[model samples]
Target: MSDSSVSLRPGSTIGILGGGQLGRMLALAGAKLGLKSHIYCPDPQSPAFDVTPFKTVAAYDDEAALRKFAAQVDVVTYEFENVPAATAEILSSLKPLRPGANALAISQDRLAEKGFLASKNIPVAPYRAVHLLEDLKAAVAELGLPAVLKTTRLGYDGKGQRVLRQPGDAEAAFAELKPHPLVLEGFVPFEKEISVVVARGVDGSVRAFDPAENVHRHHILFTSTVPADIAPGIAKHAAMLAKVIVVALDYVGVLGVEFFVLGGERPSLVVNEIAPRVHNSGHWTEAVCLTDQFEQHMRAVAGWPLGDPRRYADVVMQNLIGDEVEVVPGGIDGDTQPHLYGKAEARPGRKMGHINRIVRSE
Candidate 1:
């Protein structure tokens, strides 16, 4: 179908699953273009509901609720990957689910994600599956120490993952990740982490934003700097890698691909993970790029042609976690774009909001 033909009109409603900050930003972006959002999440105080026009507070498996929700929207998209595979399948049968259910299934499991990358000939760290203690031992022996042991599913922001620096660390690591399928990956001694946020329209055209160098504090992303300090060729390669994956999955909407850049005369970019929706790293685009990732995502899923993913300025985005929000003196300034997710409580390490500062080059 043509891009203009599929573009959602001003009065159309878009359905979103998982009412987190990403969903909130997405709804806001949609509203700017005259579209309305209907948020579907179990949390009564979901942050996205603050911006959306309609909301359905119910479990993913609530068939009656899902049916009613599906009847109200034109298209459906999810904000988080943990939104049960069956949930996507059920909703897809009722309404068009952007990005498709296969994308969620592949990204939900560490093993499945690795396999998909390998299948596409994308470079990833060496990894092995571990279903038992003996399997863990075998994987360690094969992949070696100083690796990471992570659960196969439902892990995020450094949770459900452990780093094993030596042989002695395996037993404790395994014990900690008990009662779950796990995977061991040989750690790559890399110079830095970078991510590419790309989008694919329903027509199969794809576009990618500039890669951003990422810094993690306590395993959670703290800052993202765009126009990543890397060779021009490597930056192009990163965008190519994201495009390859998006086309392979026949994915529609925003997708983020994290990479580890191993420093050398010629840096090697290795895939770290894939996020099926708009990512935190891409938040810099809000102030620096011609098109923000959230807006690009809305356009793609709405079947519009992807916008020019060009960077307009140098930018740095820092996430405000928990108590950090309290320290903002008189709140943020005009130039500093502050986005707060209307969450009721601020607990330690929770992503409360993010601020983007744009720097004009001389």
Candidate 2:
């Protein structure tokens, strides 16, 4: 159960469990530090494959292939939280899985994640577990309407969730949201969404970047502006709570903690959700910080000292979702830094790439 002794040298290979854009960024960060990455995913068109030669196109449940992949890497980490428990167990038996299986398990379920946060005395939206139509009605009655119904597992980017605006929306919403074992959450009319990306080292040291103000369009993250325009004390409090949460989990690598700044004169925060890896909200760090979130994650997972997360400038990171990628700025406006995910296709709601534009000159 103890992962304190796990550390990697410069030439060590990191085994990544998902081949999304996050994995691609992790691989690129590892390379910058004289390290290597091996991406394993079932998708042949995984964008991460373009960044590293060390890759395995195998299903998560393929135990035989998993073992082969594990043997080649020094340590294991995942790009996403949905990595199966069985797969985590198999890999942890062979190598050190950073942020550990417990963290993954908790974050994978919306109900469990909220429960865990509440147990830790972390402020979160009021929620109830829903497995039946009656349960949904009871939750709606108890928590009121305009709530969110989400699957306990296997959901992301607004994929497996629906809002219940009225009392009558229960039966249809429940039936539509197949796969029982869901969670009903009370909606907090939040003023703004913010997120803190914190890295916890193998030896218990923690470093958190400044929380970023996030904006979403049609349920997809549209932009993240760093050095969020919020009360200084509130920002500091967010960072402190984030570090405490990581310590409680005995977590290593980067963990993203999103929050809803509730309506008030001085905003009070309610935890929205947690992502167990480097998050999209922290992408602005690459444009304004010396030690970005990706590198901080690699540092933590490798049992190395954490880098300072101080920002040098304020930046806004805009995601190029779907058709947004079609127009690429040719640096005529020198404020932007373009990063394409190398995905071959551009479909609706698909994340193709991003551009980090420095908003404040400092």
Candidate 3:
């Protein structure tokens, strides 16, 4: 792919799937570049709809709506991984889809994702595929106890997964989950979780942000600190691994690679998963870097040169999940950069918004 192949003129419309906060941010970024955004989501009150110029409040399977949206947009991109494969195919036939539907299809399933990673020589946790009782038993024996059983599809924020510490727990967990294609992965006992957010342009140009160490609570992201406490060489390796995956996928847009960092003299990093869109952990880049992940994504998909991923300051991004919004008034007193997604109601464990705080080092 060449730079000249994709172009976003001043009035070109960018179609976004899944109108969440990521879509909202991507829409904002497109506006800055003199492009318009038309958000497509089933939710009537999606936050992204507030900012975008056009919105289609129809189901993903609504072929008529999908065709109409495809006709109006110059290029299409998605905010979430769960966009149906059929929906992506329909949009691709009508207009160019950024990051491509192949990335979505692979990342949406755990088994396929891990297989692709292993095929590319990327190191992921030892895993086995499970579809039945015998398969679970075999996976338990191979991957061993203290392994996690995750649904092959639609699992996120710790949902659709359970950890088994011993042998007997598998059947009950399987019964509770009840007949979903699953993957058993040996538990990775590591120091911290870290992620690399990289953007690959249509021209094959790649740029990656500094690795950020992530902390999870209730299997959801809690905090992310940039310039993670890892050796520079190891951090560089993490970024390189991310770039490799992006290029191998022929990806054009922002993608995130999560890793388990085993702290020690060697400090090995193991691939956890890949997010084929701007990640929540990279939110700090909005305030602390030369280019935010959202803007970089917009630029890349729009066929612009990848921006510099240089960080201007050390930063920490804390997610405002659920009732945490109450603390916003008190939290804003400091030098914190607060970003509240326009979610009307905040339920437990739901990601309401996030705030980024920059700490300068003398």
RMSD of each: 2.1, 1.3, 1.6
lDDT (Cα, 0-100) at 292 in candidate 2: 96
TM-score of each: 0.96, 0.97, 0.97
Superior by TM-score: candidate 1 or candidate 3: 3
Candidate 3: global Cα-lDDT? 0.90
Decreasing lDDT order of the candidates: 2, 3, 1
Model 1 lDDT per residue over 1-362, tens place:
11223567777998999899999999998888778899999998889988866999999999899999999998899899888977887888887888788899999988999999999899999999988888889999998888999999988898899999888898889999955689999979899999999999988898999999999999899999987899999999999999999999989999999999998888999999999999999999988777899999998888777888898889999999998877465668766888778777889999998899887776
> Which candidate, 1 or 2, would have the higher TM-score against the true structure?
2
Off by over 4 Å in 1: 1-7, 327-331
Candidate 1: TM-score? Answer: 0.96
Number of clashes recorded per candidate: 0, 0, 0
Candidate 2 C-alpha lDDT tens digits along 226-257? 88888998899899889889998999999999
Instruction: Kindly report which residue pairs in candidate 2 clash with one another.
Output: none
lDDT of 3 by residue, 308-349 (tens): 889999999999999998777786866789998899999999
Q: Spell out the clash pairs found in candidate 1.
A: none
Model 1 clash count equals 0
